[model samples]
Target: MGSEAKGLALSAVDPRAAAAGLTPGLPLAEARGQVPGLVSLQADPAGDRAALTRLASWCGRYSPWTAPDGEHDQEGAAGAMIDASGCAHLFGGEAAMLADLVARLERLGFTARAAMAETPGAAWAVARFATTAATPWRIVPPGALRRALAPLPPAALRIGAAEAETLHRLGLRSIGELETIPTAALAARLGRGVARRLDQALGRLEDPIDPLRHRTPLEVRRGFGEPIGRREDLAAAIESLAAALCRRLEESGEGARRLMLVLHRVDGTLQEVTLGTSRATRDPAHLKRLFAERLDGLDPGFGVEIMTLAARAAESLTARQTGFMRERDRTVDLSGLPELVDRLESRLGAGMVTRPRACESYLPERAVAAAPPFVTAYPAAFAKGPPRPLRLLDRPQPIEATALLPDYPPVQYRWRRLLHRVSKADGPERIAPEWWREIAAGATARDYFRIESEEGRRSWLFRAQGRWYLHGAFA
Candidate 1:
């Protein structure tokens, strides 16, 4: 249930509730009046989002480019968007694919409605508003989007609530009626959003789907006349596929970070092997070596007839000039580091290798974070300021200190049951909290001090809100 202008209201309802004259957005009291024993539970938006994400991931079996569509106007109904541009033939055809998708969803106890068209906008409209009880799915042929979408309501255009209400008041109930009005006149009447959405639905504008998982466009495949099950043959095929893929990446000035090898067995079963690199690269030999470490124990069910290699993730890479001198320069060459990391991760596992990266934060603890080795972007440069301690405490330790002045370094301090007299002191560098962060109430600036005790032990101390704390130690 969710709060409405009137009171607690139903955010969703099953078909039975709808048959009893109950609908989403209906007040809970009124819904109970309609059905005496209506059962309800509080809404979990986060859980719903997570469920939708999982559903989108599950749909990846159909197409790699899939994402959860939770912004549809259909009451209590969520959807997923799939870009099946080149994937239809794998499942026989578009019609067969759609039928199979719906059948699988129904078997999973979900009341599903699916549609296919030239554009996502039209498909979304037809799936939710155009399907009938006899047929819960529809496929609008190419160039038939306008004809199919004409009979749908204006709400199917994905306009705002106020816009739909305004369209209703203007006597423009159906999409056909709205299309009759000129573009300029419609924009003057309802704004550009309506016109843009209309154009998107009619395929005049481009609407691309941002996939849940990024899949690289560079790919190469090999089909054998006779199925080969030998490990040596498979290894050779991987080398050839890797070479072809690398050629394509070099042509596009890109490099792959992640690669997926799909082995299609003659028995209709598929075996997949995935590998990730520490940095983007287009070296076919390197890619082959990386895959060699992961191809062991792969089951070649009846026989593998088709092998497709796809670069699942990629990044832009350009050639760099090397020094003209034959002798090695004094500057350190970290180019081999990425290759080392790739081999280690390939043997160990993805995400098992990491490195520290600087972050954009003023807080000492938040200034650095762990990140994947050899990330594409360069690390942020540290600000030139006072030197930070070599080692920082996990959490600042409280200490009793006495200072001659309110804003000066401590003359003496007691920490961990030990007392020390300050022999030398450096600063009271004041650092203010980041303004953009959501700081707690009464949060104040910190005054840091670098001091050496009589025993020659150097420490970093900070004072906040009149309380002194030992934050770090110098080596």
Candidate 2:
């Protein structure tokens, strides 16, 4: 029950209360008159939000991307949104997934109505408004979002109660009728929200789901009956911890990317060992092997009483189907690369291994960047552009050059107090500074040229503000 301007009102009602013609926002006195023995409790909005958040977190079993539905209606009913893309196949199919989800929720004493569609908005509409007693779950097939959402009322679009009332007064009761009217006309009559919501429901506009943040890291701990100080015992403990953690990760459809092993020593001190993988993985044996390398120099320090292995960072990693025959397998298994990188990092140090990653930038220096080994970089996009030098200088060196006209390739340039005459030169390739970046006071466009010295050493030279600089050398 909630307080209203007049008196106490029903904030929400159970199925029995709803069936007895009692609705939310109805006066408690009138609701009691309609249904004599009405049981009503004071509403707790904060608690409801917290409960919904917990429910959303629990939904991580279905999909890693899950969030409590931010939109609420007059009835004060709460819901959760799950982005089950690429996850449905795990539970058989979309229909099976929905059935499983609803069945699990029902087992937990929740009356859930689930619907799947091309978009979250459509799913929300269909799940709340279109679902029936016969079918508590519905799946709007791909490319049928418009038809599925057409029959829903304007209120189903998640518009404000007043806005929905206005749409109803204007004889636009259904979403189909609202869609028939021009967006601009509807916006003029109602507001831009109606059009925007309509577009989102129909998949015309993208509606992104903001997943709930995990407050605590997924971890498993073990308390030894006797404090273990020996290296072999510690290794065995880690192996067990890794297996248990991997089991939890598999159950949640997640893989650990970074892990932290916390050791509570008997001397009231703590020892920590952190391990990071190049990619997400849940293989217990691989985790044990990786941890083995880091365990060499670990000091048990008077014996460890408790050991906790926590997955500091994790990501969704679905099950993969392996081919029966290696010869017939068309896909390459590059899983060994991450294992190698993890091994190297364990021996050397974190960030010791790196790979060149192509970046979206026009500046030669910013075009390529050092990234983690597993980060995939696409260099094919740069293939269409002029070839970049194999070796680029850390910083462009200032040089003296003699050229003709306002924009021309240098005829000769002096670098490091040595003069080199240009034998053959390519025309200047003009490159403008990125406008989106902060421009310095004297920053100007660069005109680059591929020039070869008479002695046969080719260098990349660029002229900015009529000053020449050697940027890179070509092999």
Candidate 3:
């Protein structure tokens, strides 16, 4: 029953409930009175829809074009549509694939019912309303939709409850009853929706199902006559596939950002692994090394027969030449950094390593930002200003100090209950506050000094107004 036991109705029922003379949409209280041990659970439409989507994704092993069948009604459960047109032969034949699909689903604890026809509408109708309890699957041969749908009810034409009731009152109960009527007259009397659905089922009109995922354009595959199980053989095959993919990318002047490896087992199972790069790349050797880190986790279940490599994401790339000797000597070459990042991410994870970037800000902490280590066109250069410390405190630590009058540097200070006497000191370098338009308070100037203590340690100190604070320390 529902939370407050208020107007509770049956959303669905199992075969046991049907055996006990109880149907869906009946009052829960009345059902309990009729059947002594009736069990009722609240409706979960969203959860059912999510499960349908997951089922659709899992069905991709059979065919890439798969979609969820319609939304679940109060009494009906949801289903998935798999367009196994050109893919059924891979698993022996259409009949074999259908039996395999149903058997696997049954093993997974789903009382699944499936059907296949030349038209989507006919398949949907036959799966739901035509098949009996003993015969759960119905396969209509090509050009047989007309004969297959003749015995089903008018509701199998995808009509609503009100439209089905209207048809029943007019004595047009079965789909065969409408076959003799003229199309225009039938549409004019019952409705256009009924005529449209009927035409689609009988192969007179087109009704296509949209797949949840689009096939990647940059994909290459190879099917072997015999299944391969050895790791060495798999590695060689991967190297060849990567080389071929890189050649294709080179021809198009593009580099891959993400690559997916799909292995089709001889038993019709699929295993997939994805690799990502920090930057666009077309190098076959580098791509192979990235996959090497994760090769141990990939299981060749029952031996793999068909292997495919697809570049899921890519970007245009341009060729470049090395700089002159003098220019190269002055700059550190970072060409190997991207490969290192790919290796680290392959072992640890993506986004686990980051570098600080320079933002256009005057505030010391805000000036540098940490970001994922994606390759940029230009490298960040050190800003031309007062020398920054090796490490900066989270916030400036307040200290007690005395200094000469005016803008002189401090000679002695006490920080964290420790006294330090200055032996050598630099001049006070004035630093102005951030712009007035920044909407920040304490827009006062600071006098910074580089001081050396008697123990020979260097520290960065700044004075705002009459108070001194230790901001950072030198290495």
Task: Compare the candidates by lDDT and give the number of the best one.
Answer: 1
Pairs in steric clash, model 1: none
Residue pairs with backbone atoms closer than 3 Å in model 3 (clashes): none
Residue lDDT tens for model 3, 79-197: 88888878888877888878877876776678878898999888888988877657778799987788889988888877787888888898886899977788899889977888988
Model 2, residue pairs in steric clash: none
| Candidate 3: segments with Cα more than 4 A from true spot | 1-6, 70-74, 133-135, 176-210, 217-255, 260-274, 282-285, 295-310, 320-337, 352-357, 370-376, 379-383, 393-409, 413-418, 424-448, 463-470
lDDT of 1 by residue, 317-402 (tens): 74343222245664656566667788889999888887677787788888888877655564665677798999999898999999
Which lDDT values do the candidates have, in the order given?
Answer: 0.84, 0.83, 0.79
Better of 2 and 3 by lDDT: 2
For 1-475, candidate 2 gives per-residue lDDT tens digits of 9999999999898888888988888999999898887888999888988888877866655565689985556676678999888778866899998997788677767888999999999999999999986899999999988888888898999889889889989998799898899988988988799899999998899888887744334777776868999999999999999999999999988999999887867654567788998778999999999999988778899888678788889999743332222766767765576778888988898999886667877888888787666533333335358867888998999999999776878889998989999998896888788867737654678999999999999999999988899999998
How should the candidates be ordered by TM-score, best one leading? 3, 1, 2
